[model samples]
Target chain A: AQTVTQSQPEMSVQEAETVTLSCTYDTSESNYYLFWYKQPPSRQMILVIRQEAYKQQNATENRFSVNFQKAAKSFSLKISDSQLGDTAMYFCAFPSGGSNYKLTFGKGTLLTVNP
Target chain B: DAGITQSPRYKITETGRQVTLMCHQTWSHSYMFWYRQDLGHGLRLIYYSAAADITDKGEVPDGYVVSRSKTENFPLTLESATRSQTSVYFCASSEAQMNTEAFFGQGTRLTVV
Candidate 1:
């Protein structure tokens, strides 16, 4: 079984600043995928970024990036130039490759971008 | 619109009543998933289907049932609603390609009183 952990329950960042949300997971499988999803008050789950366990380079998408450390079993999300729209509940998820396509998600980190 | 959609955006049901949540996708994805979102728990997978007529249980499968009679539709049913079953449910679909992203629906908010 794979478990994702997000130590921070809540986080706040000033507008135009940068913020990093921490995530760690436990999985015995060597091949897998890590993802960060954002859910706003609208209750829609949106994919932020994704990282392949085999890739050494981190994944970056616009202002969102991931620091994927396969050895440490850590995958953190960094939001640069944070804006009010970035204020949402961020969740770290793990999807096991192979026969299982189910996703294991962390509790989530509520991020508030204050102006 | 090449996306997934969930019906009955909001539902209210009494205890012991049967309720069904509908999920449909236009992408013709090979995989469909059902998940529940709660306050403390971010998201938990309830059930998933690889293709039509092939379904599997996920982390939290109790008190819930799902079926994929068609390629684009996956419906989740609560045989007997309970207060503990009150939560937001989300439907997602993904292709068979490796590392493919899963598209999510707006979600359905269910309240069992």
Candidate 2:
């Protein structure tokens, strides 16, 4: 069983500032995928970024990037130059490498960008 | 244009009543999943199907039943809706390929009173 943990329940960042949301997971599987999803006020889940366990290099998508430390079992999401639109509930998720396609998500970190 | 959609965006039902949430995806992904989102519990998987008629249990499968009769449709039913079952439900689908990203629906907010 894989479990994702987001220690921070809520976070706030000033506009144009950078913010990092921490995430850690426990999984025995060597091959897996880590993802960060954002749910805005519309309640639509959107993919932010994703990182594969095998890839040593971190994944970056525009302003969103991930610091994936496979050895430490840590995958953190960094939002650079945060904007108001970045204010949402961020979740860290993992998908097993095998036939299991279901995602194991963290409790989520509610991010608020103050102007 | 409709990638994925969940019917009855908001639903209200009484306890012990039977309620079904419908999910449909146009992407024709091979994998479909049902998950419940609560305040404290982010998203707990209820059930997932790899292909049509191939279903499997997830972390939280109690009190929920799922069926995938077609490749694009996966419906979740609460046999006897309880107050505990009141939460937002999200349906997602993904390709069978490993490490592929999963697409999510807008989600259905269900209230069991």
Q: How much is the lDDT of residue A33 in candidate 2?
A: 86
Model 2 bad stretches (over 4 Å): none
Candidate 2 residue lDDT tens string, B1-113:
86999998999999999999999999999999999999978999999999999999998999999999999999999999999998999999999765688899999999999
Determine which window of 10 residues in candidate 2 chain B has minimal summed lDDT. B94-103
Residue B66 of model 2, lDDT score: 94
Q: Model 1 over residues A30-65: C-alpha lDDT tens digits?
A: 888898999988888898998989989999999999
Give per-residue CA lDDT, model 2, range A2-114, as digits (tens): 89999999999999999999999999987888999999999999989989888989999999999999999999999999999999999998887665656789999999999
Candidate 1 deviant stretches above 4 angstroms: none
Q: Lowest-lDDT window of 10 residues in candidate 1 chain A? A: A95-104
Q: How far in Å is the alpha carbon of B95 misplaced in model 2?
A: 1.1
DockQ of each: 0.70, 0.74
Clashing pairs in 1: none
